[model samples]
Target: MSDIVLLNKHQKKALVIELYNQGKTRRQIAETVHMSFKDMADIINEYTGEDKQVNKPEKSKDSRAFELFLQGKQSVEVAIELDMPADKVEELHVQYWRLSKLDNLEILYHEAEYSLSLLLRLHNILKDKRITKDKDISDLIELANWFTRS
Candidate 1:
């Protein structure tokens, strides 16, 4: 695991400007810098002198809702845990789902890679043991061969 770097307020502002100049969307910049969406909007508003009123709950609250949701807790349970309204918990869960879509894709990619590696290892073991007579092992070997093919 990589070390987590904490950014000061000034550093965050500078990074926000740099990312914005690099054509990153506000949401992207916020996620990249571990900032809240509301804070990112405020920074953009400050830089561009646009007074856009974004009404979002605190980042901690939103994160708590998301954490519970990811843990398989229902919205009502999360609300009870966080002492908030169930509707609000549901709304935060939806936002968390949207925000984590890219992360989920990366997870799926890694899972597929792991599964392929396991299949290849199993195929090699079965072939070495001369167990290809089994229909399931033969099918698995074929599938592994298909995967290894360009």
Candidate 2:
């Protein structure tokens, strides 16, 4: 097998700029440029100065809610675990549940029709319930279901 030809730092920097402009992520650019992800990151940092700033990862309330949901826990459990509002937990759970279903299902065209009916039903129910409830949870659930169906 032949040895891999690596680009110099200047070339890497130029490539990183091009890739960033094209909306490719640091990791993706690193792979495409045939460099170690860390090396590519360093070059990008030198060029863009984006790495100098420290940023915290946005902790996902949805992930925590999903874990609780899998363990047979509900909104209250999620709220307690994540120290968020019960309503927020419900929102996250609905979102996570919908995404999970979409990821697992190998949906066909026919299922889309069935899914639309389900979404419309949820939408109407939520619309009606909105009159009585301050927090209309049906809307959240309906949106989630709609995305999954699509």
Q: Cα lDDT of all candidates, in order?
A: 0.79, 0.71
Question: Candidate 2 regions off by >4 Å?
Answer: 1-6, 51-150
Instruction: Write candidate 1's Cα lDDT for 40-79 as tens digits.
Output: 8788789988856444645687777888878889878888
Model number with the top TM-score: 1
Best by lDDT: 1
Candidate 2 matches the true fold with a TM-score of: 0.29
- lDDT at position 29, candidate 2: 88
For model 2, how does the per-residue alpha-carbon lDDT over 1-150 read when each residue is reduced to its tens digit?
877777787877788889978999877887878788777777767776675556657657666668778888867767887899866775666566667685333243236646867767766986776634644575666878999999
Minimal lDDT window, size 10, model 2: 102-111
Residue 13, model 2, lDDT? 75
Candidate 2 global CA lDDT score: 0.71
